[model samples]
Target: MNQPASLPLAESLLAAPLPAGGPAWLDAARREHRAAFAAGGLPDTRIEAWKYTALRGLAQRRFADGDAAAAARGVDVAAFALPGVEGPRLVFVNGVFRADLSALEALPAGVSLQPLSQALRGDAEPLRFALSRPALVGHGREAGDAFAQINAARAADGVVLRVAAHAKSIAPVRLVFVGAAADAELAWHARNVIELGEGAELDLVEQHVSLGEQAQLATLVSDIELGDHARLRHVVVQDAAAGANLIRRSGLRLHARAQATLHVLELGGALVRHDLRAELVGDGAQFHTRGVFMPHGRQHIDTQLAIRHQALDTTSSSHWRGVAGDRARGVFRGAIVVAPGADGSDANLSNKNLLLSPAAEIDTKPELEIYADEVKAAHGATVGQLDERSLFYLRSRGIPLGEARALLTAAFCRAMLDDLPNAVLREHLSGLLIAQLPA
Candidate 1:
């Protein structure tokens, strides 16, 4: 197959100068992954993973490499900031870190937060060790998809968080990636690495948003490692302009007695896809995930999740909800895998979606692969519209027909929105959904 013109930009950008000098091993890894991405090109509908969401729009857009030194005047910092959560905050504009727009709180004794580019230049061994881990059983590659590899090969800037053993953080860390309006289409790639030491705990939030109507493409990759008895609560919110294309991939590994909880809110974008994978490699490891994707108008959103139990007595649970209105489309797939000898493992997965318009569409698939006899695993999916009885009940209470429908729709999504650990964010998302609900 002939490569798209926009695809060539990835190779060109990979050959560009590195943001900072890294170890020899890290440099070699980047070159190899870049080559692999060049060979694979862009994924199309033929690929099982991308069967529903096509990449034609991404291929047709002419995206230039994001300029790291772009002025910060294009973004409004105050308007986008979270309401109540106060702590250290990092801001990135078009994938480049902006110290001028960031604020740092007094760090706890054992936590270190720095930019990935800066950490690489400082010759951090933890980063090298984390990236050196295997993507699959024998592959030591740091990425699972072509877009993830492109991010690793041409990343401009991102966050690197490290917590010392037994350290606990009371304040949450926030990372904001803002897309700037530009005359020419632009592509921005960033990779974030987070490591939590044994017995440590941290709360992290990531948000992606756009400032104007500029056509932009954003690719992000996050790699996380949790040590024994560690806990991490993560939340992701993506709200991009209608002319933007967004792709995000997250890979996580948990150790014995470690726990990871994730909540995602997908509310805005012209086209968006988020892939999340968690591997429990230690006995008693736990993973919990929940997300909500509400797409309206002609927008499209896809959410994919895979949880693997590789150790005895591990546990995994995942649930997601989606709402599609107008001519929009929503897709969800949840897969749970229990490896051989993973005895006593328990896993559950479910996906639910609602369609408010006849023209709107939704596709959902839940899968389970159990290789261990002693393990327990189940998966299911549901797609339907609002219950007529519930709508009628609301109307009988003196609410107008449109208002009744809106209230029921909002209530349906509010169930998942309430899972957010951050109270301020939950309130904000509730208001956003209420304002966007169709009458």
Candidate 2:
């Protein structure tokens, strides 16, 4: 697969010098990634995971590896608001660490929020344990997908959050990824790692947005591990330029008695593909997923998710909803696998999408593979227009047609936002949704 010539620029720019001076082991791993990414530039439909999203459009574009850092000047954090909650916030501008822009004051006991550049010098064991795990991208030694390979080789700064044993954070920890490089050709490779110690509790919010018209490419990876009895709530929102391209992957590991709830919200972006994967490695582990997306115009969004139950007594639940209008395209593919020894595993997955325009498109796939007959697993998917009955009911009340349509769409996403468990945060995100919705 010949990458569009514009990509080599990104390759060269991201391949630049490393902050830690590049360790031998890390460089070797990156070399492997480079080989893998080179082997598979843009996957075709034959690949099961990327069947719907033919990467042809992106492959043809002279995707810019941007160099517009100076243009990122004069950013107003006030103008980029999510509406509801107040808590400790860390801000990143154009993938560069902006510690000065962060509002981090007091951290809970047993919690350390250090940048990767800093962590590399402190501890080796935790870093190895987190990076040694299998990637959700690799299909085999050739590494399943080239995207992960490319990101691993070029990624720059990232946040390393460690929650020590028996610790808890009451307020949500928010990380804001803001992209506004005026140079207009910057490429950002962002990586984040989170480690939860035994019996820890945490709430996290990951936000992404671009402030300018720069042609940018963002590849992000989040690696996370949960210790025994740990609990985590994570929410992610991706909003960027209408021409921005993003490839993001998140991998998770759960130990016994650990639990997690994840919310994915895709409100904006020209092209967005998110790969979310999780594994339950301990008995009594639980996973929950809820997602919402409202795409309009020429926007394109795809979400691929999977949960693996390798231990007994694991439970998983997922529900996702989306609305596509104008020429927008949306997709959701979800899978649940129960291994042989994963007895007593219970899993349920459902995906629902609405095509608001005749030209808009949505493709959804939900799969369940249970090797253990004793395990219970089910999956379902639906793609349809607005409910006729509901629309009629709303119209009969003398409400305007456009307002009624927006109301119905909001109702669908409301359930997911309500799952946040934090009243302040949920309400805050809800307002953001309301602002994004068409009035």
Candidate 3:
């Protein structure tokens, strides 16, 4: 396959040189993936996985390589502080690790956390399985998408976290990625590898923020593994600049009796997309996710989720909400599959969206495929507006029309965050959600 002539983004990225000097196996893997990306370029809307979100504008643009002054970038550390989270922290500036801005003191016992660049410098043997993987699993036909391939080829620094067997982290680990305004449009790639040993437990918070408005592109890929009897709680908050474009993909695998839960908020960025995939490879495994995406102005946000139940008695559930105002657009897709011989499996998904303006648009699709007998599966999606009677009632009570509309909109999105355990973080997130609404 020849690289598409319309895709200047891919041509510019592939022209940049990879980091020099690594183990023979790692180098070979990078070369192979780079060649693959050079051949395939980017996927278009004709592909089933990209039917809703188009990349024509992105394909016409060109971006520089990594940021050269990432280490010297001036950032206000106090701006990103959360109320209740005070654990070990790792901060990346334009995809490069910044030791001066990180807080790594008093790390909990049995937990090993470090930057991927540092780990690769020493004994990288432990990370071979994740780094050497050919393609992202569970993505079906889009497993070899261009973004993931380029990330595998060009990524050099990211989060590398591991927990020992039976160890429990008292405080949540925070990973922060800050995008600062650069001299020119640039592109950066990151790869994260996280694993929890048998009987381990952990809570993680991932954040993406921006310092100022800059036209840049960012791609990230994360691989997560949970062993038998392990548990994980993950949260993500994304608030990038309006001129930024962000793409991310995450793959998770669960063993026997393992459990994982996730909460996500997508609020900023000119163009943003997330692909989340999970597999239950052992019996009694469970996965749950709750999320909300609000796009105002001309922003575009898309979320794709896929789950597979490959073992007996596995369970999965998802609930998500979307709010689009102005001329913005929102897209959501939820897919669940029950493999053969996987009896007693249960799965359900629901997505509800609200459109606030005549010019705004929302696209949603819910899919389910069951190949096993005695399995329960269900999925649904809806798009509509706020109730007129509720708005009228609020106006009759002396509240201004604008305030009433904001009140109802806030309530609609707040339901997804009601069950969050952390009071401080929950309130903060709620405030952010309200701030993003049209006033």
- TM for every model, in the order presented, reads 0.93, 0.91, 0.97
Runs of candidate 1 exceeding 4 Å displacement: 1-20, 68-71, 131-144, 419-421
Better of 2 and 3 by TM-score: 3
TM-score of 1: 0.93
Output the worst ten-in-a-row residue range by lDDT, candidate 3: 135-144
Count of clashes in candidate 2: 12
Arrange candidates by lDDT, descending. Answer: 3, 1, 2
**49-161 per-residue lDDT for model 3 (tens digits):** 68778888998899999999999999888857877788998999999999998988957998899999999999999998888777532334373267888999999999999
**Highest lDDT among the candidates is held by which one?**
3
Give a tens-digit lDDT track for model 2, residues 1-439.
3343245543454345433455656666666666555544556666778777776666554444434453246778784576554677777777766776677786777778866656666664567655434333344432125566566766656788888899998777888888785544556777788989999998888888887675677788888999999999998887787777788889999999899999888987787888889999999999999998778898889899989999999999999998888889998889899998999999999888888889999988888888886788888999988898999999999988999988988788788877577676677777667776755
Error of 1 at 252 (Å): 0.7
TM-score of 2: 0.91
Q: What 10-residue stretch in candidate 1 is worst by lDDT?
A: 134-143
TM-score of 3: 0.97
Error of 2 at 22 (Å): 2.8
Query: Model 1, range 1-439, lDDT digits (tens) per residue?
Result: 3243246455454555543467777777677666666666677776667889887656654567776456545667775677756788888888888777777666677888887767777766868765543222123322237777677767757889888999987888888888888767788888888889999999888888788886787889888999999999988878888878888998899999999998888988888988899999999999998888989999999888988899999999887888999999998978889999889999998888899999999999888899987887878889998899998898888999888888888888788767676788789878877877786
Q: Which candidate is the best by TM-score?
A: 3
